[model samples]
Target: MTSDPDTLWRRCAHLGRVLLPLVDQEPGRKADRHENLRTWGIDTVVGERLMEIFAALAAHAVVIDSSVPTAQFDALPVRTVAEAATSKRDFELLAGLPDSFADVRDEQAVQLFRLSAYEGGQASRRLFQLSREVRHSLIVLAEHPLLPCPTCADVLRRATEANLPK
Candidate 1:
């Protein structure tokens, strides 16, 4: 099937790629803005937010790219994090984060950014591979041909289930 221009997987890939360079000296961001975060620095909770975002995005990429029709049936695609509804609450957990950054002192904001950058780097370095492996099992389980993969349905399910709003 011809992919829609605005699928969640596509949005995730686009956003991830944009944020990818923040974790490194890369192409996405302009040098100075990137420098702004780099010049500020120590890191994980914040790094972890982007990590959850990226992880969900990655899982979406896999299942969608896997071309498994059954898997695709379970995916949810919405424009903004506010509208996103999934079993994994990671995206929504950080729902207010961006606004929080806007209100906080630059120092605090940078710290949050730094932590996010650190986790993003960790994810890139594969330091988080073991957890991904654990998640992989859920994806496998969801492949039963009848039911949807809740894991893929909500990539951040395990990571943020605890933090989900009551």
Candidate 2:
């Protein structure tokens, strides 16, 4: 028997709650953690979860737009306000994303992931410098007041702990 939309939605929400924290973990451990998530069949679950969140948000927008009378809608600008709020929420969610979860909205994470990969397996001076730069970017993004993405904040803390003088 096929699952109802509400059942599927709840599953997605549960998966997101579980996976998002893992995704917010240490950057250095991200590749390995992602591999484990994939092996445990959680990676696809998380991706599907994120998609469900987005779909629900879109449906809410549609419903709000439809509910408004056309003449009053134009005067109230409800649609525009809703779109702007959704856009900001989307950006905040993306700003919190981990390096392993690359999407169209996650360009910064992708760039940092590539930089870290390029510096791999070689204990050169440049590797340390590159790591520092990546960490700095993560911290700045995490602390950004406007968005203040909690995932970024978590990762930034992890990166700081990892890079501290030993």
Candidate 3:
């Protein structure tokens, strides 16, 4: 059975939504936050992989909310605080960030690049492992697919079409 990239992407999106209740719970409130993955029967490595996939999806959401241009998805440039403070930087600021997030700034920059590509149709192992987990999620959805929200589907479709093979 041949699987296309779009199918995999849609599956990842669905799994992300399914895992949201688990991942979105406030870490402070959930005593067994760590164990939720285990209790839910997700293995350690698979759980970690799901987290990574969620991160990529969250990153894409951030990029879209910021109104990042589709053309810029391929070459997302990073900007420093100093650069951002100065009016010279043309990069868009990702909101809701803490002032003390400087340490993870570089990591955030790399994430921006990866998420942008994923949102734009390009998938990568370094950014988000496009492995069996992603495939399995899609297969599950394929068995019983749901209609995607129009806006979300449109964005994902545009991104996939823009990034996928011609």
Model 3: residue 111 alpha-carbon error in angstroms: 18
Model 2 lDDT per residue over 103-150, tens place:
343333334333433555432232233323223333433453544443
Model 3's alpha-carbon lDDT is 0.35
Q: Rank the candidates by TM-score, best first.
A: 1, 3, 2
Deviation in Å, model 3, residue 88 alpha carbon? 33
> In terms of TM-score, which candidate is stronger, 1 or 2?
1
Of candidate 2, the 10-residue stretch with the lowest lDDT total is 70-79
| Pick by lDDT: 1 or 2, better one | 1
Q: Which run of 10 residues does model 3 get worst, by summed lDDT?
A: 76-85
Candidate that beats the other on TM-score, 2 or 3, i.e. the better one: 3
lDDT of each: 0.34, 0.34, 0.35
- Give me candidate 1's TM-score against the actual structure: 0.30
What is the C-alpha lDDT profile of model 1 across 48-153, one tens digit per residue? 3433344434444344444544335235322222123123332222322222222233325334434443566543333233223223323333343444433333
Name the TM-score of candidate 3. 0.24
Ranking by lDDT: 3, 1, 2
Q: Estimate candidate 3's RMSD in Å.
A: 16.5
